[model samples]
Target: METPRERWVGADAGPIVRPYAVTRGRTRPRGMDVDLVTLLVATGRTPGERVWLSREQRRLLELCRHPSTPADLASDTDLPLRVVQILLADLHQYGLVEEVPQAEPAGRSTGRPDPKILMRVLDELRRL
Candidate 1:
């Protein structure tokens, strides 16, 4: 059994998906899976509907429309790269944002990370 409060915002605060929409996989062949911008925009129901986005989170949501890098977001928002990384992690967990995996340069191949690494990292970080 679950309490109403447990099922509320404290439980989660990610984008709300439409019933008929088939959710897309957030993985990529390269670096990391970035957040899904189109879905986030579509989830914002009304102009006045509050989504409880932090300033940086809002800027991140706006900037991720084109697969932005955390460095770029840090520069644009005047936030530290580490801080942006933290927020992005949170957004990704709530299914709001995803990591955009980038390929290494030609002749410079690094092995792709196991998806479990990302999942474990996210789970551990969420407790903070």
Candidate 2:
């Protein structure tokens, strides 16, 4: 039998709040498309005193002060990628963060990769 103090605070103890709890039982982001490479930047707007924010969410905002990707944020926070995406979506809804649009190459109207580059990659792979 473990004492209350030992059970509550121990070297082997896990996080007090589980990942699902942090995300409010949500596995996917709502109304936002967040990918691993999606760039996110803080909107420089502070949350009001009336607004509530979780510890993880605050930390995420701090990390996003400098534009960062979901993958980078996940690695920095040591959280799962899905959790980071959900958090980002929440921040976006709150107007605390926004996605930075990636610039397109010149003369490339469509987002698809160039076929010549694909052919070159295939040839290189076949040679290996």
Candidate 3:
């Protein structure tokens, strides 16, 4: 006796999994700190070698093999943001993955370039 709301009348009708369950009731990421933009990549081998991880963690490892951010992983996997961060930190602890900080683009000048440097560049261009 389930209503339409309870059963969304689709082939993929299943109970929604809570984030707490995914994280085993953990509230915060351990040791490592992560943000939405923090990039992660696998360590060239399977993570959680001696431990059993949730299905979500395994999927995250696969997704991060080529470098992915926590935001992207959360959006793509439909997992909570905090949950993803905790999972990533856990993997990092096990040496299954590493955090790769994104660097600011080099092309962007913090402020106006030094007038002397610009003048030199202009002079060099004039010579050519």
Who wins the TM-score comparison?
2
Residue 78 local lDDT, model 3: 84
| lDDT (C-alpha) at residue 5 in model 1 | 55
Q: Against the true structure, candidate 2 has what lDDT? A: 0.90
- Candidate no. 1 TM-score: 0.43
**Can you tell me which runs of candidate 2 are displaced by over 4 Å?**
2-16, 112-128
Backbone clashes per model, in order?
A: 12, 0, 0
Q: Name the candidate that leads on lDDT.
A: 2
| Selected candidate, larger TM-score, 1 vs 3 | 3
lDDT of 3 by residue, 1-128 (tens): 98866764445846677778889899899989988778899997654447787799889988988899999999988888999999999988888889875555578656345688889989999999
Q: Output the worst ten-in-a-row residue range by lDDT, candidate 1.
A: 20-29
Estimated TM-score for each candidate: 0.43, 0.76, 0.69
Where is model 3 poorest over a 10-residue stretch in terms of lDDT?
6-15
Which ranges of candidate 3 are over 4 A from the true structure? Answer: 1-13, 104-128
Which tens-of-lDDT digit does each residue in 51-81 have in candidate 2?
A: 6889999999999999999999999998989
Instruction: In angstroms, give how far residue 20 of model 1 lies from its true place.
Output: 40
lDDT of 3: 0.84
Candidate 2 to truth, TM? 0.76
